[model samples]
Target: MLMLTLLGWLGGYLITTQLIFPPPPPPGDLFEVPDIRGGGLASARERLTGAGLVLGEIDSLLHPSVPEALIIGQSPLPGQVLRPESQVRVTVSLGPQLRSVPDVSGLAEDRAQIVLESSGFLVSVDTARADLPRGRVLEVFPRPDAILPLPARIRMVVSTGPALVAMPLVLGLDREEALILLDSVGLIVSEITEVFRFGRDQGVVVEQEPASDIELERGAKVRLKVGMSGRATEQ
Candidate 1:
């Protein structure tokens, strides 16, 4: 009875190992190579993986025939038999390496953004001084005058034209200081005399024509008053 049991166990083992298992079908042999030229890196990777092969490091080369991202050439060309798990090295075209960035300083923001995006670059705004409606091209990196090679992005700063800032309070500031503040905000100033200080502060500014906290148009002239008491000179 023991001998019979041993024989039965050996028979079951052979069947399971040889006929049923059979080394997992030799891991699905891959003896055929597929053409992956012109197929971008992503597509090429998928095909290779499907064929039980692994993609190796891809190198970029200068190829005049291939346009930018298109695959220029591949190794182990289409017909070679590749073993399963075999690594294939490939060289892809890096397109035209940009020698410099394009000039887009004066160009509108929308147009500039489009151009940069097409070149595979992110449109970055280092500093935005103005927005739409103010209308103007402030500046851009790489400059509008300079010529740039292909495969590069054009970064730019769009102008909102001129800045419109509310005038600062200058009631308490002295004449020179008030004039300085007015000039800083691009305001024009005219000096006049107000006789209200009653013998205090003669040359000192008595009051502003437009007064404090009043929003005046840019470049508009505002009058300044100086000095006190009944007979103040309105010069």
Candidate 2:
């Protein structure tokens, strides 16, 4: 009788255990994994959920061509059959890789542009007059060594040479007066042509090449046509 009572207690204990913890339902059946590559995270989640599968851990990686938060790869791949409610792993793209901004200051503008572009960065040129050499880069935006995403625009300050000096209007002025005016502005007389213009005073400038108000470099040459009392000039 004691053994029989022990057997009954054992049976009751087994039943209680079964009721409290039953084995998980055999994987709800198999379903094909949908292609989630190139899809955004939200869309990928929806698709996976609809398939009775769960979106698994996401791994982010930098891809040059893929956009951010888009799936670049998937575990088990697309079209694979797996038990329902199985977790699907995916690799998400963090967009293009970020690059360190190179030191381009003091480099020439064209050279700087080339270097930045080669390093996968876009470039913008801002010009200013500096004591630095013409076309040299004076400063850079985001500064050197700053990390930025690919295709990011990097603005650089470039020299537009020393402060601009507009050419003075020396037309109709006498040769002596024109010479003095050009000299005062760091310019020099390159050539002088004598022309005969009726009613014009001798040694008076009749025409000047490059006209006036045009930007010219220091010590640049200015050609002048001087009025003379003779018509013995080439046309």
Candidate 3:
């Protein structure tokens, strides 16, 4: 009886499995992954999804030289076999990894750009803080001297050094003193103009060209306003 019961149990188990389970479908069913490894993010996303896939969460990682938003790598690697709806696990190239921002001040704009590019960075200029002579680098973001990383985006203030600079204040100073100061600096004495505003004496400098205390390159010319009130003859 024990032997018969054991045989019956084994037969039932076999019958249930065959009836409950079926063979898996054939492997030809899957979505094709488009080759977008080095394309722009938006374009890649559009292309990938258009082809029947979705963009996975972006993972930020350090790269040494690749541009940002560029696909460093892709999931489901191009031509790899994956299920149609199977979420492909991809490891994209995070483009040249971001390095610490370098300090690029005091360097010429062109030179700075070259340096930054060599060190894996892209550079841009801020015209507002620039001087004349566009190629000269007037100021660099992140200070003058600091360590920076690759694939860095740097905005610099380039010098159009020829741009006008504000003149420095020299009011209340004697003509000789003013002339000396102006000459010492990059300023020239554009003839001194005499004015009689507010009835204050003549031949005295009333105003200055380029205004007071303005920054300018050496040799800037200033037109001085001198008081020209001639004195009446005292009898």
Residue range with the least summed lDDT across 10 consecutive positions in model 2 = 226-235
- Who wins the lDDT comparison? 2
Sort every candidate by TM-score, greatest first.
2, 1, 3
* lDDT of predicted model 1: 0.69
* Candidate 3 weakest ten by summed lDDT: 226-235
Q: What are the per-residue Cα lDDT tens digits for candidate 2 across 97-167?
A: 88999998899999999999999998888899876779999999989999987878899899977665689
Pull out the clashing pairs in model 2. none
Clashes of each: 2, 0, 48
lDDT, candidates in the order shown:
0.69, 0.87, 0.66
lDDT of 1 by residue, 76-124 (tens): 8888987788877788887664444555556767776776667555566
**Model 3, CA-based lDDT:** 0.66
Better of 2 and 3 by lDDT: 2
Error of 2 at 181 (Å): 7.1
lDDT for 76 in candidate 1 is: 80
Score every model by TM-score: 0.36, 0.46, 0.34
Off by over 4 Å in 1: 1-94, 97-102, 111-122, 128-135, 145-151, 159-181, 190-235
Model 1, 89: alpha-carbon shift in Å?
Answer: 19
